[model samples]
Target: MLHDLGGLLFIALGLVLVAAGFVWQGGALRPLSTKRAQAAAMRDRSRNLLRSADMAIAEARRRAARDEPAIVTVEDVTRVACRHYGHLFVEREEAAAALRQRYEAADCRVDCMTDAFN
Candidate 1:
């Protein structure tokens, strides 16, 4: 009788361990998926920013070539760059806001602490 009880206890303990493992894995996987999605999104955003910057530079060069003004100043290039960057900033802000909303919904943390540090 005692042997049978020991076997039953062992079986119960094994079942509990298996259940705990599944629960732990499920919890861990949720965060990993969120992180992977965030990373992919960030990469896509960076690629878009780079493409926009390249196009803006090309357009500026084309404009300058066509205009052929008497004086081509650094300010001219800077003005065009600022305009390009401003548009990019607006788009990036919108994307970031959307991501933040998603993260909040998932109960995940968004690391915007850099703004505070700066």
Candidate 2:
């Protein structure tokens, strides 16, 4: 009877440990999932910016090569690029600024130079 009780106790302990592990894993995964979603959003924003830039550059090149009185300049290209991608750029900048403000408010230090380098 004592041996049976000991075996039951071990099983219960094991089950408790397994449950605790799952709970811990769930808690840890939530933050990771959130970070992943943020990262995906950032990637999508960047892709949109690049696509807009590409379209603007192509349009500018086409305009420049055309036989027209108005020749497209570098400034015109830049303006067009900004106009095309302005929304995405502004959103990304806003998100970054908000993140920076939150980090500063929390007294968390960020490597700004490293971010600029990237």
Candidate 3:
């Protein structure tokens, strides 16, 4: 009878240990799940920004090819900056200044009058 009782106690102890291990593993994975969610959000945002930038550039190219005036706007400047630098985390003034410089230097615009006609 004592031997049988000891076997039952050992089995109970094993079950408890297994349950504890599962709980610990679940706790460890919670933070990983959060990180994955944040990463997915970031990836989605990047895709959207890239899509917008591509569309803007395409439109500009179309206009330039047609020998039409393509006025670059603030949004266009930001999109260009995002295309090159991912997302701007700089101060408003600094980012604006930097993006303005990038926009000015970019050959994104062709000489429509010369290139398209000639």
Candidate 4:
């Protein structure tokens, strides 16, 4: 009876592992949350991204005021975002894009952080 129980336990564990493998391979075991919940979560994520972008931009402005290095490199902007809001949600490209738009809107020719990358 003990041997039979052990065999059954092994079989159960194997099935669990197989299911996990399928899920890992994109077997559509995605979070079964409501659409409204997913939308709200996406909105929150966007808000966090915006806030991080704003914080990074503000840091760039402070650095400008200091007249230290006139050059706001991508690394500098990324570091500022990571310092305040962590790096997971901070997209350097997106932040740079926003900065370019804002700067150009005011007819300014300031070199952007992404210019170094280009």
Best by TM-score: 4
User: Can you tell me which runs of candidate 3 are displaced by over 4 Å?
Assistant: 1-32, 76-118
Question: Which regions of candidate 2 deviate over 4 angstroms?
Answer: 1-32, 65-118
Candidate 4 colliding pairs, count: 0
Q: Each candidate's TM vs. the true structure?
A: 0.32, 0.34, 0.36, 0.41
RMSD of each: 16.3, 14.4, 9.9, 10.6
- Answer with 2 or 3, whichever has the higher TM-score: 3
Cα error, candidate 2, residue 26 (Å)? 20
Candidate 4 residue 18 Cα shift, in angstroms, is: 46
Instruction: Name the TM-score of candidate 2.
Output: 0.34
Collision pairs in model 1: none
Estimate every model's Cα lDDT from 0 to 1.
Answer: 0.46, 0.48, 0.53, 0.58
| lDDT (Cα, 0-100) at 41 in candidate 1 | 74
Which tens-of-lDDT digit does each residue in 5-118 have in candidate 4?
Answer: 999999999999999988788655667679879899767755554555455555666666443433445455556556765655556676565445544553334533435335
Better of 2 and 4 by lDDT: 4
Model 1 TM-score is: 0.32
Tell me how far the alpha carbon of residue 84 in candidate 4 is from the true structure, in angstroms, after superposition: 4.0
